[model samples]
Target: MDANFAFLRLPDPRLYRRSNLTFSLLFLIKFGVKSFKFNTRLKMQEKLVAAKYEISRAVKADLAAITRIYNASVLEQNATATLRPVSIEEREAWFDAHEAANRPIYVLREICDANLTSEDGETFEADCERKFDSKGANLGAQKPSVTNPKGEILAWGSLSDYHPREGYRITAKISVYVAPEARGKGLGGRLVNFILENAPKFGVKNIVALIFSSNAASLNLFAKFGFARWGELPEVCDMGGKIESLTILGKKLG
Candidate 1:
C-alpha cells in the first residue's frame, strides 16, 4: 500500500481493547456517582421521617411559640428586615389577620411520645407533664387539652397577600422561618413543600418569595421547588446598616 493508504489501514487490536476498557470505566464512574446521589437523598428523607414531625394549621394557642421562633430570627439572623424582637401581642394581631380559608399560617412541631425517653434518660412524658402542670396553670382555660397535646414548635410558614389590589389577589408571598436550633434539619424544605401543595386550594395561582440576595440558603431552598428569580431590588433594605438587597422569586402552580 502507498504511504497515504497505510494510514487508513485497520486500527490495532490493542487500541480496540483499550477503548473498550476506557468506556467501561467511564460507565462505572457515572453509575457510581448517580447511585451515591440517590442514596444520600434517601438517607436524608429517612432522617426526616425518623424525627417525628407534624405540620398543622396554626391555632390561637400556638401564637406564643410562633412569635418566639420569629423573634429568634430577628435577634440572630438577617432573615427578616425587622431589627428588634416583636411582642406576643403584636404577633397575636398579625396572626388574627391570617384568614384560615385564604391566607394561613402553618406550624411544624416535634411529636413527643409518652413512651419515648431522651438521651439523658428523662422521660418526655414526665417532662411534658411537669411543664403542663406549671405553665398550664397560668394559661388557665387557654391550655390545650390532653387529647390535643401541644408539641414543641420547630418552625412556621405563612402565605400572605402580595398586594391589597383586586388584580393581585391570585398572587401570594411565602415565608418560612425555622428555629435556630432546628436549622439544617430539612424543616425548611418540608414547609415549602406543604405551602406549594396547598396554595392552589385557596385560589392562589402564583407564589413568590422575597429573600435577601445574600441569603443563599433561602434562595436555594425556593429554587429547588422550581421558583425562578423574577426580579430584584438592590439596596432596598437597610438591615441594621448592612445594606441588603432583595430577590423576588416566583413559581406558578397548576
Candidate 2:
C-alpha cells in the first residue's frame, strides 16, 4: 500500500509538469502573434511616410504655429520685406481675408500615422500624388498647416492684388516664403509648385513673384517653375547693406 501511494504521488508530479508545458506553449503563440502585428503596423507607417508629399488648405487652429514660423522669417534680415515683426492679430486678419476669398494656405508635412481619407474629400483629405510638368512627384494628400494656405501672411505664394482691377483679376502679384525651419527641404519649390497647379482652380491665369535679385535661391526656384522675367524695380531697395534689384518673375499658371 505504501508503494502504491508513492506511485500515485509520482504521477501527480508528472501531471504538474505537463500543465506547465502547455501554458508556456500557449503564451509563446500569443506573444508571437502580437509582436508580428506590431511589426506589420510599424512597417506600414514607414512605407506611407516614404511614399511622397501633398498640399491642402490651412485652418484657423493652426494660426499660432504658423504665426510662430512667420514671425521668425520677419525677424530675419534676408527673408521678408518689412523690418517690423507682424503681430498675431495682424496675421489673423490676413488669414481672414484669404478665408473670405476661399483661397488656401498649404504646407508640406509628413502625414501622421493615423490616416483619415475619404473618397468624397471630407475633413482635410488629399490625393496621394500629382503630376508635375517636370519630373513627377509623389506629393501625397496633405492639408495646409496654416489658416491661409494661399495667402502671403504666412508661408505661401500670395498675389498682392494683381492690377487691383476686375479685368486684370486673372493676373495677380504673388509672393512666397518658407518657414526658417522649412527651408532647404525643397519647400520653396514645392510651395510654388503646388500653388501653380492650383491657380486655374482659383481663376488665376497669370502669376507673379516679386523677388529680390539677391535672393538667388528663390530666383532659381522660380525659374525652374517656368517664371519668366516680366518686370523689375531697379536698385530701389537695400537689404543687409546690399542694394538689391527687385526682379518680378511671371508664370502663366493656366
Candidate 3:
C-alpha cells in the first residue's frame, strides 16, 4: 500500500475512522474561517459603496465631535504622540488658531435620513411641516431643513503650518483621523484626497505627514497618494515606556 494510504489500512478499523473524522473536522473549521473572513470583507465593500458622505469646513458645532475623535487616538497611543487626552478648551484654542491662519479644518460626515425619525413616528420633514402649518407666516419657526442632512461625523482632516518661519509658509503638515467604528471603509482615503485637493488653495506647496513609524496603515495610505519617505527620527516618542520612531513623509503639489 502507498505510504499516504497506510493510515487508512490501520490494524484497528476504529482508529482509522477516528483519524479520518478528525481530519475532516479540522479541514471544515479552516475552510469555514476563510469563508467567514471573505464574506465579511465583501459586506464591508458593499456598505462602502452604498453609503453617502458630505465633506465641508468644520464649524464650532463640530469641535466637540472632533475633540472626542482626537482624544480616542490619544488614548490609543498608536497614531499620535500625545500621551494624555486633551481638553475641549485646548481644542477650541487650536481651532481658533487654524481659523485665524486660514488653515482650514475639514470634516467628513455620513449623510443619512434614518436618524431623522422622531419618537412619535414622524419624519423630521413631516414634523417641520406640522410646526409650519400651526405657526402661520413663521416659516423660520420650523426646524431647519436640509437635503440629505448631516449624519454622524466619520472623520476629519486639517492642514496646519509646518513651521512658523516665513520661508515655511508654503509648506503645511497634514493630519487625518477616522472614528474607530467607521474605519476600514475608505473614509480616511476620502478625507486625504479632499485635503490634498484643497491644499493648494490654502497656499500649500509642500505637504508633509508626521506619522509614527509603527503605523503601517497610515504609511500605506500616504504612499498611495505619491508621498515619499522624507526622513525618520529614531526613538523620538516614548509612549508609556515603549520607544517609538517617527517617519516624515512628504509630497510636492504642482
Candidate 4:
C-alpha cells in the first residue's frame, strides 16, 4: 500500500508535457493570425494615404479659396505675371465665365488625414486663410472672414477658352496655381495632368500654356506633358520694375 501511494504522488511527466505543448501551439497560432490581420490592415491604410487629394469643378463657394490660392502665386512673383494681388470681386466675372463644357476651373483639395484628428477624435479643419499684403494689412471686405476647414483648396487648374472665334473653338489654354505652403508637393503637376487628360472631353484639340521665360519650373512642368515651344515674345510682360519674356508652349491632342 505504501509503494502504491508513492507511485501516485510521482508526477505524470508525459501527460503534463503533452498539455504544455498543446498550449504553446495554440498561442503561436493565435499570435500568427493576429499579426497577419494587423499587417493586412496596415497595407490597406497605406494605399488610402497615397490618394490624399481630390479634383473637382470650382463652385461659386470655392471662388474665395481659389482667389486666395491665386493671390499666393501673385505674391511669389515667380509663377504668374501679375504684379498685384487680385480681389475676389474682381475675379468674380472670370470665375463665372468658366463653363463646364467649354472652360472648366478645377480645384485640388486636400483630404483630411486620420492622424490629424483632435484628442476627442474629431478631424481638424485646414486653415484656408488668405495672406495679407506686404504691409501686413488685411484689405477690406474682399477677404473672407471664415473659411471652410474641411477640404481646403491646395491648388487650382483651369482650361480657359483660347479664342471666342468659331474656328478656334477647339483650342484652349491651361493655367495652374498652387498654394504657397503647398508648392513642391507635386500639386501643380497633378492639377496640370488632370487638365490634360480631361481636356479632350471638352472638345479641346490643342492645349497651350503661356509661361514666363524665367519660370523654369513651369516650363519643365509643361514640357513633361509633351508640350513644345511653339512661339515666344521678348519683353512681353512688364513685372513691376523688370520686364520678362514669355514662351508659348502647346500640345496637339487627338
The residue-by-residue lDDT of candidate 2 on 127-233, one tens digit each, is 32322334442223233346433222224445445665678868766666666534566767777777787778778888888778777887888899888999899
lDDT of 4 at 207: 95
Q: Write the number of the candidate with greater lDDT, choosing between 3 and 4.
A: 3
- lDDT of prediction 1: 0.79
lDDT of 3 by residue, 118-205 (tens): 3333333221221222534211111224632465666899999999888999999999998775688788999999999989998889
Backbone clashes per model, in order?
A: 0, 13, 0, 1
Q: List model 4 lDDT by residue over 13-107, tens digit each.
A: 99899999999999999999778666555554444333568899888788898999889888878778878999999888887777633589999
- How high is the CA lDDT of each candidate model? 0.79, 0.64, 0.80, 0.78
Residue 59 in candidate 2, Cα distance off native in Å: 1.8
Cα lDDT for residue 180, candidate 2: 57
In model 4, where do residues sit more than 4 Å from their true spots?
1-50, 113-150
Error of 4 at 54 (Å): 0.6
Quote the positional error of residue 53 for candidate 4 in Å: 1.0
* Per-residue lDDT value at 152 in model 4: 64
**lDDT of candidate 2 at residue 89, scale 0 to 100:** 81
Question: What C-alpha lDDT, on a 0 to 100 scale, does residue 194 get in candidate 4?
Answer: 91
